[model samples]
Target: MSLIDELVALHGVFAAGEYSYRGDRFSYKGHVSEEHARMASIMCRATSMGVHMQADIMAGSYPECGVAPAGGWVVRGPQFTVCVMANVFCFLDNQASLNAVMSILRTRLADASSDLI
Candidate 1:
C-alpha cells in the first residue's frame, strides 16, 4: 500500500505536514522537525527499491512528562516533515527485533552529524 493508505490505516489525524498517533501528538514543529520528512522520504525511496518496511515520523521529547522516548510514537505513514530543529532526535526502536540493522542506522546518523560538531 501507499504511504497515505498506510497512514489512514492508523486512524490518525492528518494535516498539511503532521499526524498524531494516539494521545501522543507529533507536529511539524519542536523536536521532530523536517528531519522526519527527510527520513520518511528516504524510507519511501528505499521501500520502492525493495526495502519492504514501514515508515513514520517518530516523536523525540517530553522530559517533564517522564515518558519513555522510545514510546516515541509516530506520525501518519504519508512521510512528512515535522520541524527543522530536532531539539533531540529520539526513536522508538523495533524491540531488538532488528538490532543488527538498527545499529548501522544509528552509526550512520551519528557519523552524519559529526559535521555539526
Candidate 2:
C-alpha cells in the first residue's frame, strides 16, 4: 500500500494527506478537507522558516541557539491532534499513537530528502 494508505491504517489516524510547500494539496485520504491540509502545510512551513531565520541570526555566537530546531509540529485538540511535517499531515485522535505515526513519517521524509542529494 502507499504511504498515505499506511498512515490512515495506523490506529487513531482519521485524516492524512500530502501537500506542496506552496500550500497545494497533492492527495489526501480520510475525513480531512483539501483546504485544511493545504493550510496546515502553509502554517508549518511558515513556522519552520521563522525558526530557521532565528537560528541563522544566532548562528556561531550562541552554541545552543540552534540546538532546538523546528521541523514537524503537532497541534492537539480535545478530540484530535494534527501533525505537520515536511509536506505530510495526519490527524490522529490518540496521543499514544503519535509516536508510531511520527516515526513512519520521519523515515519517509528522510528517504525523500536523500533522493534530492
The candidate maximizing lDDT is 2
lDDT of 2 by residue, 1-117 (tens): 887899999978988887665544457798767677666566665665565566556765776764434446677888888786666778889654888998988887764541101
* Superposition error at 37 for model 1 (Å): 0.9
**TM-score on alpha carbons, each prediction:** 0.21, 0.69
Residue-wise lDDT of candidate 1 within 8-78, one digit each (tens)? 22322121122322213433322334766445434433332221111111223333443322212222223
Task: List candidate 2 stretches off by more than 4 Å.
Answer: 35-48, 51-69, 112-117
Clashes of 1: 3
Candidate 2 local distance difference test against the native: 0.69
State the weakest 10-residue window (summed lDDT) of model 2. 108-117
